[model samples]
Structure formats: C-alpha cells, structure tokens
Target chain A: MTVAIQLGIIVGYLLLALAIGLVAYRLTDRTAEDFYLASRTVGTIVLLFTTFATLLSAFTFFAGPNVAYEQGPEWVLVMGLMDGIIFAILWYVIGYKQWLLGRQYEYVTLGEMLGDRFASRRLRGLVAGVSLLWLFPYVMLQQVGAGTALQALTEGTVPYAVGAGLITAFMILYVVVAGFRGIAWTDTLQGAFMLVTTWIALVWVLAVVGGPSAASSALEAEAAHHLALGSDFYTVQWMLSTAITIGFGVAMFPQVNQRFFAAGSKKVLKRSFALWPLLCVLLFVPSFLLGAWARGLDVAIPEGENVLPVILAEYTPVWFAALVIAGAMAAMMSSSDSMLLSGSSYFTRDLYRPFVDTDLSARREDLLARIGVVGFATASFLASLWNPATLFELGDAAFSGFAQLALPVMVALYWRKTTRAGITAGILASQVFYLSSLFTSIVPSTYAGWTAGLVGMGLGLVVTVAVSLLTTPAPDERRAIYFDGLEAD
Target chain B: MSRPALWGWIAVAIGLSALTIPWFLWGDATLVAGVPLWLWWHVGWMGLASLVFWLFARRFWGLGIESDSDSSGGSPGSGSRVDAGGERR
Candidate 1:
C-alpha cells in the first residue's frame, strides 16, 4: 500500500482508458452526427449503462460516502438517496417525453430543442450561454475529484497538479479523437468495472467489520441521534427540496440531453430509462451503508471532504484498496469525458455554427467541436490545480444554477402562448437573482441559492405570460415563420 | 388529457411518501445510526416512492417508447435505412 504502488495502478488504469478511447475513435466516422450523437444509433444496453455511468460521477462515488461518514445516519444520507430516486422517476415521467421530442426534431443539444420549440435564435443563444457557464464548474469539480483521489491514494506522491494534468490530457485526447461514440463505449466498460469494484469493496468491508448486523448495532450505540427521522416539517421540506433540485436539474442537463438524442429510437431510449434505475439502486445503497458503518466504528474523517476514500484505503487490504481506487477513477473519467463533449457541442452547434458563420459545413462544425473539447479540458484541469474549498458545495451550486432554467424552458416548450420576450426576461431575471445569491450572503441557509433561483423563475414566468397575452399573437402568415424549416419526420 | 392514469399514479406517489415521513415504526427500539427507526422508515418510504413512480410512469406513460423512424429519418416504408457509415439511405 505504498504511495508508489498506488500511483502505478492509477497510471495503468488511465492508459487503459485511453487505449479504449483510441479504439472507439477508429470505429467512429468523421461526421457531425457520428461525432455528436453517435450516429443516432446507440442501442438499449449501451444507452442504459452509459446513462448510468454518466449520472453516477465522482460526487456520488467519493463525496457521498464522506457525507455519511461525517453526518452519521441523519437527514443528509436520506436526502442523497432520495435525490437519486427522484431523478430516476423524473426521467421516466418527464425526461422520456423530452427524449421523444429530441428524436422527432433530430436535436443534438438542449439549445437545439429550445430553439426549435420557441422559434427564436436569441433564446437558443441564451440557453447555450447559461448551460456552458453552469457546466464549467461541474467539469472542474470532476477534475478536482480525480486529482484529490490520486493524491490520497498515492499518499501525495503524485501532486494535485500533476494528477489533474495527467487525467485532463487523457480526457482531451480521448474526446477530441473519438467524440460521442468514444465516450459511450468506454463508459460501458468503465461502468461495469466500477459496479463490480463497489460490490467487492462493500462485501470486504462488511466481513472485516463483523457483518451488517454488528455494524448496525455498533453504529446505533455510538450515535443514536443520527439514526432518527426528523419531524414531519423537516422531512417534507427535505423531500421537496431534493425532489425539485435533482428532478429538474438532471433532466435539463445538456450532457444528458445529448444522450437522449443519441439513442436510435424512442423505444431504445425508453428501454434505457426503464433499466437504468435498477443499476442506480445497486450502486448507491452500498456506499451509504458503508458510510454508516464507518460512523459506528468511530473513525475520524477529514473536514470539508477527502474523507471516505481516504478511510477506505487506510482500512481495507491492498487489493481491495486498489479496486476501490480504480472504481473512483472510473467514475471520474467516465463523467469528465461526457461533460467535456457536451460543453464543446454547445459552443460548436449553438454558438459558433448559428451566429459565427451560418454557412459552416458539417465537417467544419465537427472540427470546431473537437477543438472546443481540448480547450475546455485544459481550462478545467488548470482550475483543479488551484484546489477547491469543498466538493459538495461546488456541486450544489452548479445544480442550483442549472435548475433555474427548468421552468422557463419547460413552459416555452409545452405552452404555445409563451412569448420570446417573456423567455428573455425570465433568463435575465433568474441569472441576476442566482448571481446575487452566490455573491451576497442574503440567504441564511445552505440551500438558499435554490430558493432564490426558484423565486426568480416564478417571477420570470409571470412576466412571460403577461407579455405574451398583452402583445398580439404572431400573424397566421408568421405561424409558418415559426415552423419554417421544421419537419416532423 | 387521457392520461388521468398518470395523474392518479402521481397522487399515489405523493400520498405514500407522506405516509412514510412519520416515524410510526420505531416505537420502543433505540436509534440505529443516531436517529430513531421512524426516521429510517421515512427514508425507506421516500426511496420506495421514487421506485414506484418510476415504474408506473414507464409502464403507463409511454416514457420508454423509442421510435426507430425518428432515427432512420423516415416512416416505416419510406425507403430510409442506415448505411455502414450511419447515414440514411
């Protein structure tokens, strides 16, 4: 369990991932659809695993256990578990509808769908801009997680900067060369590896700690208060906040939307959605229980994160530790590639192709997307070197920022009376409120950002509806103007 | 909308979740992970609620349907099919 050996194992895994990426690149053609949507032919099984892998990122794998370790078996674990379930249900109820529309419209990005739905290029630009801004910090957090895991596993032998740099290089090279096909195929392999390793770690830990019953008894004896449910008021608020935050945010994320569009048919997409939740339950519950067991053992973890993985390495045997490290790395790399691809696609399709040059060919668009992938990966890697104050805080901020767009976007899509003027006003109002909440400590609670964002969203909807009703509807001749160039297929 | 079934399911989900939030199960047992068993019951209920919602929605809401025509760029016999390079032909 020396630092050198741990570093060696991590490096080997990175190389293996890169090799997988290169093979996928060879299989992928140099076309806009292939590069962006995997030629819209991804099957059910691949889609299911890729979706699962992308959703279960470093935050869930590494930071979730840390939360359980620190907070015991209190509301935090309940909140986290509830968030995952909510997201799965949201995907079925609402997210699948959007996927069907994505297929119908041949949409490769959320911005594309919005532009088509609203019939406004300006709205598309605004959506793309806000998405890029929200996703940057999320991508940066993944880089930080990879670097921190490397540093911990290697006992600081691999410095944060070097660790981040190595992973970034791999991500950039893989994404730039392979695109969506590369990310999806590698994600399938990595997702399987992580699932197996997680079970192995859980079983080994349970056996070593004298089984789940002993662990449960020990944890109960140590911190009886952390095990109880909060009052009805607290549970209701906790459930509502979690359900809204994750339910809305996951469905709206640009990367996930891209996956929805990539599936070949609505049937394939639906099947993937049906199968994904089972994998999530298997992946999430064990980690939460492990954290609970740690609490019972009275193990002291670091403050503000870097706690769970560190504890795993310290307590587990060398082989099991290596497997856990591999799983964490797999989660990090799988998510990072998808995020980088989505961010790059936003700039290439929505920002560059539409405004910068309308005559740009598909080939040129693909090239720009590849270049954007490299640039984004490099920037996030540098940010990771600075070292974040905390992982969960950064993640929560990103989630709240993206959740602000949910109401306006959904309203515009399903409600014909929603006006362009209203969407503009809503975007500006929500961004201002969200930014103010971030900079000023006006909100007293940790989730104040979400509350403020929701308030702004509500105001924006009112303004949009009022303005649309006041102004005359677009003329009948102009009705074709909105639907122009749009084919239902 | 003919999807009253969908609405009915959503109500059931909300009701079930509400029921689980009260700690009605852990009467005399001491707490497990620092909280009483009733709290664990609540979390369990939330998790169950999520599962039920997902299953019912997918089964009744057409949430899992995939239209191959959308990907192939044509209706069932319109002569469009994917080639080796993934282009519609």
Candidate 2:
C-alpha cells in the first residue's frame, strides 16, 4: 500500500511535468536562441525557482541531510550560510559579467564566449570538454540519488535501475520537447515541491520527537557532541573549504552559467540573486533538521544509504513519506533535467557545430542537441546502476573540478591581457592538482585547512594572472571581439 | 551606484562572509531555546545578508552592463540571432 501510494504520487507528478513541458514548448520560437535560452526573456519568479531547483539536487536532499544526521547540524552553516552569501556574490561577479558579455555577443555557452574572445578553437573545445567531463559525474550523482531514494521509499518494490531509468526517460522526453522554456516551467513546480515538502518533513519529524526542546535534549543525551562545535569533521577548515568549493563551483556549472545568459534583463538577475540566501535558508534548514533530528529518533539507517528515506518511512505517516519522497524525486529530476539540457547545448553548440561542422544549420544543431540529451541521459542512467562511488565523494570531486574553471573564466571576462595559453594552462594545472587528490595522496584532498579544490582554485587564479601579465596581448582586431564597445556612461 | 560605493558594498559583503562561519563560537556550544547558538547566529546573519543583497540590488541593479556596451552589438540581450563565433552586427 505504501509503495502503491508512493508510485501513484510519483507517476502522477511526472505526468504533470511532462504535460507542462510540452505546453512550454509551444512558446519556443524554434530559433536556437528561443530554444536554448527562452529568447532570453525569463522573468524574476521563474528565474528564482529554476535556479533554486537546479542548484538543490540529490546533494541537498540526501547528502546534505545525511551529513547533518551523522556528523552534526553544523553542515547547515557550510551550505546554508557560507555558500548562500558566496554564491550571491558570485552570481554578481562571474554571472553578471558573463551576462554582460552574453548580451553583447548573444552567447549561449561559456565555451562560445571564451573561445570567441580568445579566437581559439582549441580553447572552445577545452572549455566545453572540461565542463562535460565534470558534469558527467554530477549527472550520474543525480541518477544515483533518484534510484537510491526510490528503492528506499518503496522498500525494493521499485528496483534501482528502474527508478534511475524512469527519470532518464522522462528527462529526455521533456528536455527534448521544451528546452529551457519547458525546463524553467517544470523547475518552478519542482522547486516549490522541494521547499514545501522539506519544511513539512522537518515539522513532522520534529513533532514525532516531541519538539525542538525535547529533540535537543535527546540529542544532548544521546549525541551531545552534535550540538557543539570543535569536532574534527565539522572543523573550520572542513566547513570553509567545502563551502568555498560548492559556492564557486556552482557559477561554472553549464546549466547555471547558461541561465546567466537567459535572464530577460539585469533586473531579473539582480532580483533572483538578492533573494537567493533567504531561499537557501528556507529549504536547507528543514532538510538538515530532519537529518539532525533523525539522529535523536529510532530511525535505523543501514550503512551507505541515505538517512532521509529511512526517516520519512519510519517517522512520518506513510502518505506523507510518499509525498516527500516524491518531492525528493522532484529535486533530482529538476536538477538532472537542467543538467542534460545545458549539457546538450555544450555538446551540440560548443563541440559539434564548432569542430565537426561550422556550417551546421540551426535546425540541425537543435536536432543534435535533442539527440545529445537522450544519449547523455542514458549514459548517466547506466552509470547510476553501476554506482561507482558514494554521493559525497562523487559530488565533491565534481564540485572541485568545476571550481577550477571559475577563475580562468573570470579572467577571460574582465582582464584585457588574458591570453588563450594562460587560461588553458591555468585550468589544466589546477585540475591536475585537484584530480590528484582522488587517485593519489601526494596532493592531499585537504591540506593546511583547505580543500584540494580551494587550493586548486587559488592556484588557477595565480597562474592565470601571472601568465596573462607575461603573455603578449591579442591583436587589436581580436581584442575588439569583446572589449570594443565598453565605456562607462 | 557609484564606483566607490559599489566597491564599498563588495567589501561589506566580504566582511559578512568572513564572519559567517562562527570563528568565535568554535568551542562554545551554547544552545538558545535548545538550538545551537552558532546556528542561531547563521539565521540572524542570513537576514542581514538578504538586507545587504536587497539594498545592493536596489542601488546597483544595473551593474553598469546597460551603459557600457558597444553600439555595434545592436542592442543588449536582443538574442542577436548570430552564432557565438559570428561577428556582432
């Protein structure tokens, strides 16, 4: 019965999303600009919800809460407080700058922007290749989360492969059907689902444990250490590094960076970011509280499984658990859908059209992006079934890898002397150091109280600046590609 | 927003971000109303961040992107129907 209700709610939600996606597609102008960026006219409300949904994925639903449950609630500060402010700042620094350039050049992808500015096909290929590389793990992470959550919610009634495949199939349909227009519409729905259900889940769980005071006392008695700071796990370094990695990394995610171009006007972008920190607070608090409070309850979480489903199933009513789990599925779908959509743009526009066929027509390019969506989603679904690493591990590596690109991209945007070689070298060197953390211990993942990604980001910034100063400027004609029209009023 | 004022707000944002992690309360596990004091600090600090961001939004919404573009690019965000590598008309 529980499985039936869960399946029913989930299937119903998916159908509603599909219908919405199909309807949103009617608004598409069939032009590349309209398809990829919704004609760059997205307003404030939809923009906020889509971005919120896109950013809060399985990590927010499963990994973040699990961290709070097992370790402590200090995970909140890293994600909620630190990342919130940092990302708002980055949305301005990196995103706004990109928005300016994107407006002038009508750029749809970072690869397009960077590659054009430097006048290097290799740089375009490099930027697109790096994004797709890191994005693969993130896509796989979403699939894994979806499959695992469903499996847990239904108590194995729904197989992991089936759950993962279901979302993949649905994503391909909707993403190919509507593009960013469809995506923004469904993301608004999913974002609301996530926020509403997470808050209700917290309240439900907290009520079951009596109340905040009682739960706090229970934690104090059973897990007093969770309430306090000074632990090695939630240390200043761990919190700071994790926050920095995820915060900076987000701006470089193709899906998000693309939204920087999709904003209708600067007002839309400014309003969305201005409200971002508060939104983070709303969703994160309840989600983390569920995990932290679960530690005080009688929830039995087997090793390597997410604590959220277990808490929902054991504590909340069966119907409510099913609803919230569907909400978790909502979070994962919103995230993966955006990933596949933007990844398609990267693959089709940045890689295929540029390298494979410069003369590729817009209609064919659009068709290829649809095909890319199906292909990429299938690969991720298969990888989820394989389930290589834990959620946190995969998520962290992806974050660190993405973080390496942010600084180089920033330099390309703001600095006039930025050379192709300098940006390329910076990205490559930083990623080399970052990737070493996983495969080898020589370059520790965290050193001197900094994450490998944080240190790597710093390293990339330094290399980019130093190399830019050392390299000769691009010729005037080439420089005019980006810098020609800029003068303050 | 003027150049100096924009930079000043950026500095203020930086200051708030630096203090967000509760460096002072690392060892202090004091709970207010059964919630961790540090967590409470985050809640309050977030309100301040929103205010700062809101104020910044109201003042510097333009980020100077509107007035700085070259006239050759047509108009800003017209979705100029050109390829990324194609020349801006």
Candidate 3:
C-alpha cells in the first residue's frame, strides 16, 4: 500500500516537471539565445537555484551521505564548508568576468566565447571536447543514482535499468522541448523540492532518534571517529584536494558556466554568489548530520547503496520516505536536464555550427540543438547500463577532469596576455596528465600531497603562464574582451 | 582596485583558505554538544568567508568589466558603458 501511494506521488511529481517544461516551451522564443540561454534575462533567484541544482547532482543526493555514513561526517568538510565557500569565490573571479564578456559579445556558450577570442575554431572544438568528455559520465552518474534510489525506494520492484531509462527519457523530452528556460524553471522547482524534502527527512529522522545530541551520543559510543575531521581518511591533504577539485570542477561545468551568461543583471549575479554559502548550509548540514546520526540510530546501510533512502525508510513513515526519495529523484533529474541542454549547446554551437555548417540559420541551429540533446541523453543512458561504476567514482572522475581546465580558463579571463597556444597547451597537457593517472600506474594518482586533478591544474597554470609570456597574441586580438574597464591598452 | 590591491585580496584569499583546512587541529578531540570542535570551527569559518566575500564583491565588482568606452576596444563585437571607475553610472 505504501509503495503504491509513494509510486503514485512520484509519478505525479514527474508529470508536474514535464508540465513545467511544456509551459516553458510555450513561453520561450525559438531563437538560439532563448533556447540555450533564456535570452539572458534569468533573475537572481532562478539563477541561484539553477546553478545550485545543476551543481548538486546524484552526488549530493546519494554519494555524499553514503560517504559520511561509512567514513564519517568529514565529507561535510570537503563539500559543505570548503567547496561551498571556495566555489562562490571562484564564481566572482571567473563567473563575473565571463558574464561581463557574455553580455558584451552576446555569447551563449563557453566555447563560443573562448573560440571567438582566439579566432580559432580548433580552440572552440577543444573546449567543447573537454566539456563533453567529462560531462557525459556525470550525466550517466545521475541516472545511476536515480536507478539506485528507485530500486531502493520500491524495494527492488523497479529494476535499475528501467528506473535509469525513465529519467533519461523525461530529461531528453524536457531539454528538447523547453531548452534553458524550461530547464531553469524545473531546476528551480527541483532545487526547492530537494531542500524542503531533505530537511523534512532530516527532521523526521532526528525526531525518531531524539535529535542531534542523541545522534552524537550514538556516534561517540560506536563511531567516535565520525565526529572528528583529523582521521586518516579525512586527512588534511585529502579533504583539501577533494574540495579544491570539486569546487573548481563545479565552476567549470558547462551548465553552471552557461548560467553566468543567463543572469539578468550584475546585481542578480552578485547577490546569488554572495548568498551561495548560506544556501549550501541549508541542505548540506542536514544531509551530513543525517548520515552521521544514522550510525547512532542503528540504521544498517546496505553495501553499494545510499545511506539516505535507507535512513528515510527506517526512520520516517513510508509515504514520507517515498516523497523524500522522489526528491532525490528531483535532484538527479534537475541535474541531468541541465546537462542535456549545455551538452547540446556545446554540440550545436561549438561542433555542428563551426565544423559541419558555418552558414546554418538560427532556426536550423535550434533544431540541430534539440537533436543533439536527444543524442547526448541517449548516449548517457546507454553508458549508465554499461559497467555501472559507483556514483562517487564516476562523479569524482568527471569533477577532476573538469578541474584541470579551471586555471587556464581563469587566466584567459583575467589576463590580457593569455595566448591561444597557451590555453591549448594548458588544456591538453593537464588533461593528458590527469587521464594518465586514471588509466595507468606509471604515474601515481596521488603524488606528494595533492590529487592528480589538482596537480594537473597546477601544471596547466604553469604552462599557461610560461607559454603566454613567451608567445605574442595576434595583432588583431583585442584587449577589451577580457580587460574592458581597465586603463591599460 | 589597483593591481597591488587586487594582489592583496588574492593573498588574503590564500591565507583564509589555508586556515580553513584545519591541519593544526590534528589532536583536538574536544566536542561541543555532541559535535566535534572541528565542525564548529568550519561553521565559524564559513560565516567569516561569506561575510568577507560579500564585502569584496560589493566593493570591487565591475573593476575591469565595466567601461564608458567598452565598445571602443578593437574587438569585433562588444558593448558596455560605465563611469570612470566601474560602477553603474
């Protein structure tokens, strides 16, 4: 009986999301900018929520709490505190600059902006390539999470592939029909749902277990290490590297990067970033505390399963657990839909428009972008069925891959001297080093103290600085694109 | 902000980031209200970081991104207008 009502509610919620997409499609203009960027009129609340939803994926819903449940609450250090604040700082340093340039040039995609600056189609393709390569796994991870959540929520009544496929189909439809406008609206809805439902779950769990002190007392008795940050697994080096990697990685996400351009005004952008850390605390504090408290409450989390659904089922009423699990589904779908939109933008703008047909019309381009969404989402769905790595593993790999691009990107934005060759070297060398660490044992994945991703970022920065100083920018390459308000030529 | 002033902010960012890591709290096992001291430290640090960021964002925004003759730069397509310093005019 509980499963049926829970399933019914979840289905209704999914339909509501589709309805929002349909309405967005009705309201949105068919132009490339409107389809991909909402005509750059996204307000502060929508921008904040969309970026927040896009950044917090199945990783937040599943892996984060699971990690805390197993290792300790120290995952909060890596995520809630460190990543939450650092990403906001980078948003100003990188995102604000990107937004300014986006408005000036009317740029809708990261590759379009960077490629235009260098006058290099290859550079555009490279940026698109890097984003797509790392982004697809993340898309797949969302499905993996959705599948895991549904299977757990339904008590294995819904198969994993079916659960994964369902979200993928819905995401493709939402993205193709509504584009950025629809995706952003749904993201706002999903963001609110995730926050509220998660808090309810946390509150219910605490009520059942007798609050924070009780959870803490349980941890002190059985899992004392869970309360502290200096454990072997939560070492300073590991926490910092993880936070650095994820934080910069989120900053470079094509979906999140695209949001920088979508903001309605500078004030909206500024307010969103300023309040970002506080927003993070609202969700993550509950998530980490719930996971930590589950130890005290004697919730037995299954191997390879998320701690969230388990705790929800054990502590909360069945209908409430279903609702919250659906909320987790909300997080996953919100993330996947945004990924599809951005991935399509990367395809149609960077790859299709540039390489395949330079003279394509805006309408034709929009059509192709829709097709691109279908293809990317389908590919991700198929990838989800193949091998099916853990959520944390896939998410971490993608985040690290994206993190490699952060330094060169920031340098390109803030420094007028940054050259195309410099950016190219930075992107290529860093990616190669990071990939080698992943695939081969010839180079240790962790060298000295930092992870391969951070090392790759450092290496990229060095190469970018050295090569940019050594080489001269094109005579026609203008300075105002990057440094407009400055007094310098 | 001047170049040196910008660099000063960068230095401050690094210093604050260094403090956030809690490397020095290796042996501290003190727990307040069932939560470890480190977690509380983070809550405090995050509060400080956000406050500082809010101030920096307010004071130093649009430093080089806004300009009265922004369109005058030789880029193929770009546009903006601004005061002598880069706030809305």
Candidate 4:
C-alpha cells in the first residue's frame, strides 16, 4: 500500500463518517436532546460499541505495545489486564448507580449531576471548568496520534501540521453538523473496523514470528531479564496505581459520563456495560501479543514509545500494514470525536446556558452547542499542533486531575445531607492540591501527586458531611427538589 | 442493604485481581511469542472480567427485565418547575 492509498482509505472513512452524521441529522429534530443524547434513543448495541470505542483510544492501541516492549512481560500483568478488571468493577459498582440516577433525572452532562446533587451552582460551574480544561489535553493527544499515523503511513510525504489539520477539520465539520448522534453512529462503524484490524494484525504478526509457540520459545531463550516481572514491589505498586487511576478516573471522565446519560434506559446502559468487555479483548489483547512478538524479532526502534507500531509497519506486508494503520486511525478518531462532543456539551449546556443566560430557549441552546463544538474543536486542533514530547505523561496528569472529582461527585449522589459549602470547599481543596502537586516540587511523581489530591478530596468530603449535619438542614422542599419523584413506599 | 450482592461483587473483584497478579505464574513456563504463560494470565484475567461484566449486565440490567410503564410523560411530582409561588414555596 503506497502512502497515497493509505491517505485515500482514511479520507474515504472520514467521508463515510460525515455522511452518517448527516443522515442522523435528517432523521432527528435538532433539539437539545437530539444534539446531546441522540434524544436518548440509543439502543444497547450502539451504546455498547460506542462506549467501548470511546474508551479504547489511540492511547491504548499505540501505547499498549510500547509499554509491553519496555516493561517486558509485567506490562501486561500490571497495566493491561488489571486495567480491564478495574473497568468492569467500576461499571458494576459506580456506573450502575450513575446510570440509574441519570435516567431518573434526564441528566445531560456530569456537571448537572453534581449541581443537582449538591445544590450548588458554583460547584457545577467548577466541574464544567475542569471538564473543559482536561478535555483539551486529551483531544490534543488524539490529534498527535493522528499526526503520527499520517506521518508513518505517508512516509513523511505530508507534514504533521497538514495531517492534523485535515483530520481535525473533518472531525469538526462532522460534529458541528451532527452532534452526539453523529459521533455515536460513526463510532459504531469505527469500532467494527478497529476490532477486525486488531485480529488480523495479531494473527499476521504471530505467523511471521513463527506462531505463538515458536515466538514464546525464542523469547524464553533471551537475556535473563527478558521475561522477568521486574522488581516485585515496583510491579505491585505500579499495577495498583494504574488500576486506581484508570478505574476511578475513567469513570469520572466527562465523555464516559456523557455516554451514561445518552443510553435510552437503564437497561440499555447495563446491557452495553456487559457487552463492552468482550469487545475490549478484541481491541486490547492482540496489541500486547504483537508488541511482545516484535520485541523478540529484534526490531531496533526508538526506545519507550516508537517501538511497537514502527516494528509492525516494518515487518508486516503492505496490505496488513495498511489495515493496522487504519485501525490506529480509527482508535484516534473515535476517541477524538467523543471528547470534542463532550467538551462542547459542557460549554453549551453546563457553562453557557445556566450561567450566561438562564432563560436561553432550547433552540438557541442547540445552536450555541453546535457553535461551541466548532470552537472547541478548532482550539484543540491548534493545541495538538504543538506535538507534545510525552503523550502518555500528559494523559496521566490529566486523568489525575479528573480523579479529584470522584469524592465530591459521589458523595453528592448518595449522601442526601451534603452541603453546598462542603462541596465548594471540596472542589477548591482538591483543585488546589492537584495544581500545587502538579507544578511544585512537593509531590515526587505523578502517582504521588494523585495521592495528595485524593487525600485533599477525602478531607474535603469529611468536612462537607460533618458541617452539613451540624448546620441547619437545607429546607425540606429544597431537598425534595433533588429527590423529585422517587417513592419511599 | 444487599449484603450478599455487595460482598459477592467484592469477592469476585478481588479474586479477579488476584488472578491477574503474577504470583500464580511464578513457576518457569515456556514463553510463547516472547511472553510467558504467566504473562498471558493477565490477558486471561481481563477476558474473564469482561465476560463476567457482560453476563451481569445481560442477566440483571437488560431492558427485558424492566417494567414497561409509559413513564416518559411527566409523572406526579415531576418537579420541572422549581416553585409554584413567587416566593420559594
């Protein structure tokens, strides 16, 4: 496959996605519900695939192989498989509760859930602010991945800026015109391509490396540290940290929360949750195996990051190579669309409507959301042009900040007596702690900074709960406003 | 509180986490594709977790089990309006 053919295939895929979005637009009214949640009509299958696609982005596809290459076998043990289990548990324990609440309230975004639960406009605003901030870096990561793919497949024929711009332009147009409905429908298609690409690459890589049995034997005979799990203590600590970061952080991600709200019903959400893990195997497992096999083949590449995909492109036939390239592109675009859509929704529904103009009509709000989507996509695309030195590090830092939301948001959901003062204090405390840890020398590393942030959040929650109980309770009517229609009988 | 359900989920989660941990795969095994069987244990654990989640969602949270009441229309105490009077009544 020449660079020209690869570019053509990617361009075709983008056009097909845009057409799907346009079709969805014609089928549904351009109202807030339709723009935000596809009128909450997403069935179990669409929801399931979209959720899976959104979660497993270019980061998983590109970085999983790199991590496996560097960390030896422990990468799969500590990060790969453990992360999946964490997601499952998170879905069962926290996500189910969120789904039930989202259905009950018809929540549009995560900020709405926080505001309604804690009864604090400021807290809601704070959440919206954080969401918008974190989404920029995340969207930038996808753009960088897209740039990498274009550069690799084109053999540097196209410049990085041009590649990123084209991808971002296509995404912005599709999203602004179609909204969540457009993104979800396109994700369903992209998700299918990703699964097929992954399976094919896995089998082809294994065959080239002389099958799984031969590959394993070759790896075992390597240097002493080849298959070792590294330091036991470090491995356990890394695994635990990775699990917590991904489990709680991913659950709190604005895009994932948006998906929770988009499900047509609790049943749809739950069924989707059940089916997503199966899809994850097809998406994740093969990358680890392929990366390990590449290492055994002694493909000398750049250390840390550039090893896995480069090896694949170097070793595999042009046709299979094109498929892998397509898969990587699929991963990047699927995630980028969801992030752009979620960020735009936060800006329109959470930030703009309530604070800027409480009386903005539904029609005006929908228009504003479309405009916001374009603006955010443009800004994120510009940011992606910087081509940050460390994509995974930036992602980890952003997720750590997102994790700070867990305590305040969770308490507000289940704790009826949560006070506004506590919620505000909690958000401030967590943000301050996280920002300080991030910028200063206080925390030694990313994990430590996350620990400090979690501690601050914990303390803030204690104060919020304690003070609310001691202070005069919010008016019963006010409490009932949140409880709305739930029955006690 | 549903202790059985809660504890069951906790136990299963812990068991799955343990399965992914490399302690069980400590013994020397032939490496396949430059990865030991122990390493593949992690993949197996993830696969199982995914399977369990799928099953739980299908069996317990499916739309088929839900009551098909027409609750889309506003119900009593829908609370769309914050207050009836000019005051916060």
TM-score for chain B of each model, two decimals: 0.45, 0.65, 0.66, 0.54
Candidate 3 C-alpha lDDT tens digits along A187-271 = 8988888888888888787787777787788877887777766677777778888889888988888988888888887667767
Worst 10 residues of 4 chain A by lDDT: A480-489
DockQ of each: 0.14, 0.30, 0.28, 0.22
Compared with the true structure, what per-residue lDDT tens digits does model 4 show for residues A243-262? Answer: 56565677778787677766
Model 3 clashing residue pairs (backbone): A485-B64
Interface RMSD of each: 7.6, 6.5, 4.4, 9.7
User: What's model 4's lDDT at B29?
Assistant: 55
- Note the residue pairs that clash in candidate 2: A485-B70
In terms of lDDT, model 3 sits at 0.81
Please rank every candidate by DockQ, starting with the best: 2, 3, 4, 1
Query: Which CAPRI level is candidate 3?
Result: acceptable
**Which number leads on DockQ?**
2
Residue-by-residue lDDT tens digits, candidate 2, A310-404: 88878878888888888888888898899998998999888998888999888878788889999999987787777657888888889878999
**So what's the TM-score on candidate 1?**
0.85
Which candidate's lDDT is highest? Answer: 2
Q: Which of candidates 3 and 4 is the stronger one according to lDDT?
A: 3
**Clash counts for the predictions, in order:** 20, 1, 1, 5
Q: Cα lDDT for residue A489, model 2?
A: 16
Supply the DockQ value of model 4: 0.22
DockQ of 2: 0.30
